[model samples]
Target: MGAFTRYATAGALVLASLPVAASARAASATAAPAVTGAARADVTVPEAWGTLIAAGRAGKRGIAFGDCPESEMLPESLRCGTFSVPVDYAHPFGPRIELAVSRRAATGDAAERQGALVYDPGGPGAASITFPLVGEWSAWRKTARAYDLVGYAPRGVAPSPALSCRRPEEAAGTPTDAPQQPSYAYKRERIVLARAYTDGCVRAAGPALRHYSSLDGARDLDVLRAALGEPRLTFMGTDQGAYVGALYATLFPSHVRRMVFDSPLDPDARRVGYRAGLARSRALESRFGDFLSWVARHDDVYGLGTTADAVRGHYDRLRAEVSRNPAGGTVGTAQLQAAFLNAAFYDDYWAMRASALAAYAQGDPEPLVTQASPRPYTAKGDENADAVRTAVECNDGVWPADWRVWDRDHTRAARQAPFAAWAGAWANLPCASWPRPRQDPLDVRTGRGALPPVLVLAAERDGVTPYAGAVELRRRLYGAVLVTERDAGSHGIGGADNACVNTHLETYLLTGRVPARDAECAPHREPNALALNRAVPRGTGPQHILRGDPAPAGS
Candidate 1:
């Protein structure tokens, strides 16, 4: 499909919209050691770059000592250190890329400690300072409590030499998924921003942008392992983070131990763009249908219509209303698209949407405004987001390299899913306009070779990384087991009951055992009593709107 405008309409629950082309792409802490007096696992560098990389590739490990540079250290459980890795792995020592490393020493008790397990938070762009502190995520606080938790920023990311924009606040505003159509003028603005962002990074980051992909990032992780003094690498990845974990396993199979990949990214879909990018719209349409049913039952809450169809009609009219006029000239397509993108992620905003509907009906946009400009993280330069997003994605693989190819694909996808068409394309406008040519993206493929079993979890209908990706990944890795969350469909394992998922997850981390075979856990729909509009299940009722937990799912 060629790029077009994103129009949110009530169709057969799913419709395609055109997408613009050009845009391209795109931690934990440890605790004290349990055994202090025991001999430290002896790890020594051969003092030769070839020896080090070779041994690492061969799965013969090395010991990690204190961090590289004191200045870069994070004042957390894990002390910060830098290791010398080749700026380009092919040219070790020619120029060096600093691998920012952090480590929480073993609780000083060797017997109780299961060794170091490094966890990676996704973003290809989230700093990895408190990775070990993610015990709460794994349901293995006791088990992980013993191992050293470690994390490091990817190259050109924070905690490393970090790429730059003029300011950090550039990251503000809800990052509404840019739809894939040209009708939205924001499409053109986004392209300009992406180019400007890349220019700034090039000026500031120098040559670092060339080696910031998962290929090199995976290499950096190996270097982290060598410095930390571990026998093997144990890791956990979520969303796009899973891709990193999968690649690590592929590149350093012997060193991989007990990898737990949550919210699996479908690298296949990533290779063939339409599947992964459009899954959100498909998932949202299904979930929105559910929301409309709820809205119909709570007719008093939103007087749009009594039946689900009526509720949908209300939305259809609302979309057209906003598309043509917006709320009393206060809201526009960009603002409305942003709100819709954010709202579709969770249930916390039904009332907000209801309120917006009520207000828009009366020509007000405050409800929509509140959502359009959400503050999910500390804001950095909007330029930083634009740069970081493009730098990573554009470098990972060649996007269309041909806008015409992108146009055909997007036009096709939009006809099937109008809600996200333009917005999705806009999110990636940077790739289309990227200044650099991309290498073929890494496959992150793992053939049927038995690996030390790992735990892979996914919500069946996850909006970002579809559950099928988990299944595909499991088949790729020799012994990996995948557990499906039937009803949960967002990040953090769909934020479900947590009991069943946790029980299995903790067992794997604590005992190194896998479920008998690939399995599926029952779906945990947000109970009506616990329904909060957000993807996370943290706060219920109005409190839900106030607290954010389990961060939003990413593409």
Candidate 2:
């Protein structure tokens, strides 16, 4: 069958299966995480929360909405505003910082409307305010019509109180890519550079650096929830935001209503040092295997190879050649891996990634060269984006101070998942010397009654936040139902037109019911591009460029 026909068939199957969604939920609930543990006779909010709620109740000031600075670029209906939140929650009346917030009122009937559905697209550094403007709106719009869609720029991110790192001119010349089989000299240089980066962030942000952790972001969410006048918080946190939401639920369980965590981070991994590294390494390796299969299937078109092993060998040879000699002194082995690794996360770009690789191998280096060049940092608030990405991760939990910890972990991980192991290590190296007190990773446990019925989504072959993390998160949050998109390749799974996943999401949002047990969404074959001579669709709008930031690769 043709690719279009295949996709249509998948759509039909997805639709035909929806009539059983209610029964499916019942069937799935049987397999869901045990929710019988956290049910205490006296479930209570902390003293801090009670105080904040009291303060909010007394103040009587509603959220102040104004013309969004980006309104000209956005649809007129989405309003934007800012509110002062304490730099430190403990010192509520002390130093204050502004938070950027945007809201799109519900389009559904006002009588049936739920409260605001706050969203965090998870970069820890990614501006949440941008989600309503640019993210996959249709996926949630069905339920969003009755509820306000709200997004925010967390502290130390763009347009809020953004943080900065005083990067030196010489620092700009340092190679950001992971050096393959580095010599002792190279290792020493890397250590020095990592120290410099950390120092620069400390110098630029000062004490503010300590206030940018995920825990702090969660607190900020409470403040936002109060400002919006919602009695309880309804949220959707993806990627790192999953950790943020998890922390919020742990810190203020009674305040949660409906929550959705997609492609979640393992709360356990976040607290310790380098544990997430292993998870990321394995995820990348699994994705690499998927890429190999794709290339093998299209050997007739690309002439790379007709077997998975042969395709992998061809790739290994190409990468090795590039490591020895970068093409046009731009696309090095690391650069090539970085560029195409995007394919492992989202199948939408596989055709382009493959075409670029095939072209590079045939001696035209422009495709790979252009794909690998770093984004120009001239965009507004780009430096702050870097600062927040580093600060939050560094302060969130203790990263081992000793270089040997990374050395041991990266060396072991590289042996198995070479594509991203060392590269990820170098990407997150700044945490080693971060000039802030390291908070111990939170032991985020969810007992039976600890939280509301949450929905967790995961793609089996996720490249950044691994599927294992999602499973672990589901188990920790007792009663949470996990929706797995089997063999789906995207880092974020909700963007596609998958009825199985969307039905669960909309149902849970509209009625607070989930599939009773864990469930799976059948994978749909990605639509293939036409021949090389056909005009390829250009990627438009704002794309997420989070290279060398906190994440493994993608969000």
What TM-score, computed on C-alpha atoms, does each candidate reach? 0.73, 0.83
The global C-alpha lDDT for each of the candidates, from Candidate 1 onward, is: 0.56, 0.67
Model 1 lDDT tens row, 52-144: 443343232333445435543334455665555556554333455555656666554677788777766565465555454444443445655
Over 296-335, each residue of candidate 2 has an lDDT whose tens digit, in order, gives 7888777778887887777777777777777667566655
TM-score of 2: 0.83
User: RMSD, each candidate, Å?
Assistant: 12.4, 12.6
